[model samples]
Target: MEKSKIWVFVSVLCAMFVLVACAPGSGGSPTPTPLPPVSSYEKSIFTVEEGPIVEEKQLMGEIVPSRQEELFFRASGFVTRVSVKQGDVVKKGTVLAEMQVDDLLNQLQQARIDLEVAQANLAKDKAQREYDIQKATAEVTIWKMRVADAQLDYDRAVGIQKEKALLNLNIAKENLALAEAALKLVQENTNPYMEQAVKRSQLAVERLEGLLAERQIVAPFDCVVLRAIIRPGQQVDAFFVVFVVGDPSELIVRSPYDFDLASKMTDKIEVNLYFDSKDEKGYTVSYLPNFLPVTTNKEATTTRSSGDYFYFSLPKEIQQQDLKVGRTVFLKVILGRKEKALLLPPSAIREYKGLRFVIVQDGEKRRRVEVNEIGLKGTDKWEIVADLKPGDKVVGP
Candidate 1:
């Protein structure tokens, strides 16, 4: 019994020792203290810089004719031959195309027949006028003969009357009056016939003038043929687009600019262009025109650039192949610039109003700084032009 009691006491003592060893803070070995919580505030720094930043604006435009014109057959005819093809250069009155003269010739023949008929009518009318004049002259001669006979009778009557004999003097006077009436009637007819002949001659003159104008097809202006809308032997009308002609010298590049960006630009702004179809060294600088073009955003890639888009003439490229009038090319324009400006990640700055501000860490204190002349440095980065000194802390992106 005594040995069992001693063994039981020993086991109880050993269990109590294990409990004391496992208990918190009982063993001499130290407990790891919880580390202090880290503060949530952290940021970066930048220096206020003085340098240049190239401020630029990008715009898109199209190649267009100085003037685009749709050439058509002013009159009707089968196109006999097309002397020009798409992309052909032509001069005014160069006869880029010709019509089968068959119809024109037929019309000419008809016009000639009409002219002949007019001539014949004119001749007939003239002849009638001459005949009427001759008849008037003959009638006047007959009247003069009758008047002379009446005068002789009147003289004989007057002599008889002077001798106190009964005579018919009144009847002689009435005969003279009737002859004058007949002469006036013939003269009136002759005058009317001459007037009618004059009218016919005037009509003939107008018909000849119209026919001459129709026989020639001439270009109205200098232009490049963009497309041949008509083929040989094809009959075209005044409304048909026979040739899409444009003056290459009139070609201009058109580009879209963001509206907000465009508002900041001035007239005669400088721009650079790159032609995908041409070499990169072909960069050309052009000035913006005095007036901005009216445009709608519904047709553009974005609605924001409607009033911001513009056009520039490809003054030098007009002579280059593939840079023809009405051919489109790409363009870029530079608006403004700044030099060697101190910059920070745009993410580091907070923009408000027109002014940009950044939070700088001064030891443990955070201070707000106003950035002047904020310029773009790169994607999502900006250079601040204001009061940041070197070694100043900034909120980093």
Candidate 2:
């Protein structure tokens, strides 16, 4: 019986060893153990505070003159002369450039000569008509005197001599009548065809002069040539810009009109401008209203309503800076501001689905508080309206 018991114990020991060999620690995959719960305090935490919330918008702009002229040619031709170059100070009506207009000049001269000839021909006709009328009048008077003499002779003579005198008197009367008719014709006649010729020639001269003017570019105002686009012998098309001139003494910053900025503008709003070539120091500028007249060129002085650009007048000192036209600039405007508001970092706010909330700490407990409204979102912080106070602590997502 002792021997049988020893064998059963050995078998049990062997089975136990086999079961241990088949266990997970020996060959099968081990089960994972769960980690401890993480505390909300371990994550990022922020405390709401009362501070000024300012909303600023930045836009790219360009420096420009307050009033400028874009000079262009009305007719296309090869540029024959460029009298002024860039930065040339000039007076009004100063010729800046000219196109190939030798033909135009020759045509204009011919038209002027033609006009002179037409005028001379008209004058000559007038003088000749007067002389002819005078000559005809004199002939009529002489014939009348001869008729009177013949009539006297006819009345004093016998039969044959009376007949001869009557015949002479009749002949003299006919001559006098012919001379009077000639004088009437001369006095009543008008050389309308000659007068029309004179008018036509004058119009041709004026037309040529106008065409000649189109081939030249003249300064419209006293200005400095900001840019000279046409070089000598450059071919250009009609209405092509040849020069950009402006009063450099008066400069302004211009940009594309922003509808978003326009909607936020108020009477008390301020504008700040930063030039790319300069430091971060901002310059204050005044916004020009659309109703104000802005002279663009000599032909017209238009208002801002006629253009799609924004204008801001700079301080005189700022205008004196070495800023070039079309230089890139940055503009900043404070759209809204609140002096004492509940401000928090954007990261502290949490959004799930469509609801925005924040994890607020209440003493020893944390609770989710819904953000009722967000106002004046700034660069680094957000103005939040919630049930929590300014001193509340919030956990980040």
Candidate 3:
């Protein structure tokens, strides 16, 4: 019984030792002392900078060709030849179709003949006038000779005392005056009726020739035929747009812009363009004459721009192929620009109730700086023309 008691006491002691070894903070790898939490506050040192920052405005625009003119022949006739149908690509000055112009050709031929006749008549009329003037001059000379004879006869009458010679001299003087008057009238009065007739004939010829040419439809430029409105044997009216021609090589970009900004826009504003891909320096901005509706972003802080669409022809590419028409692109226009100015990232800026402030770390003490936004570095950076120095690290994206 004593031996059993000793074994029981030893077992109890071992049980207590095991409990103490396994208890928390008692032995091996004592509950790893909890580490102090790391601070999550990020830091952004700032420095004053003098650099160029462009005030960029990003807007969407569509690519389009420079010209998309409707093809038409300002003549009414039956379509006899359809040289080019829809979807045919053609060179500049290509004949797209021809109209039945047999009647017009006949009319043109007749007009030419009539013009020749009128020209001949005008020449004959002018010759007739010259002949009349010459005949009148000759008659005046003959009358003068007659007047001299009569005068001589009258003088002889004075010697002979004859009344018949005096009366004949008086008649000769009257005839000479009549001939002079007739010559003066012919010289002063010229007939232009034949010249007017010639002009009328010339105009008729032009009209007929133009009508004959109008029978054919020609492509105005290097274009892709988009549509053929008239078919063979179809009669078209004058000034009918029978074909649609579009040139892809000529291109432009049309987009909506902010109204207030555009109101101050000049035709000489600088432009930077961006395509769908992230490639830069492909195209420069150009000022377009036409305006469009304002572009808006519902999610933007400033939702709407000034109400005006911008139109600019796409500049020639640098070893690049033609841009696709009707494709969407991002256009960045520099509304405002500043050279060599201090800049800060948008993160440094914190907006309050209608006020903008930045938290500047100055010599270990956080200080709030009120800065005037003078310009824009980019979409998120601001170029400030304020009292700031270089070496100020700005901690923001």
Q: Give lDDT per model, in order.
A: 0.61, 0.82, 0.72
Q: What TM-score do all the candidates reach, one by one?
A: 0.47, 0.59, 0.46
User: In model 3, what is the error at residue 268, expressed in angstroms?
Assistant: 6.2
> What would the per-residue lDDT of candidate 1 be over residues 1-397, giving only the tens digit for each residue?
9999999999999999999999988858786799999765543445444455665554555665645555555567677777778877878877777665555456556666666766676677768767766766676576667656655665566554644322333454465566567657655654454456556655655665454344334555676776676678777664345566667664566665455665655556666776664546556656565433322223222212225455565556445676655445666566555656675666777777777788877778878878777556544446667787756678653
Candidate 2: tens digits of C-alpha lDDT, residues 1-397: 9999999999999999999988866976777898998886656889999999899887777776667767788887788899998777899988899888888899999999999999999999999999998999999899999989988998898978888888998998998899999989999998998999999999999999889888998888888787787788889887766677887656777778788778776546787888763567888877776722244454422212434776777776664455776578888877888898999999999999989999988888999999999999899999999987878899889
Q: What ranges in model 3 sit over 4 Å off?
A: 1-52, 57-72, 75-100, 158-164, 167-203, 206-264, 267-333, 338-397
State the displacement of the C-alpha of residue 298, model 2, in Å, after optimal TM-score superposition: 14
- The residue ranges of model 1 lying beyond 4 angstroms of the native Cα positions read 1-50, 70-112, 116-219, 225-244, 264-267, 276-282, 288-309, 315-319, 326-328, 352-356, 372-385
Error of 2 at 109 (Å): 2.6
RMSD of 3: 13.7
2 or 3, greater by TM-score = 2
Candidate 3, after superposition: displacement of residue 5 in Å? 56
Sorted on lDDT, highest at the top, how do the candidates line up?
2, 3, 1
List all candidate RMSDs to the true structure.
Answer: 14.2, 11.8, 13.7
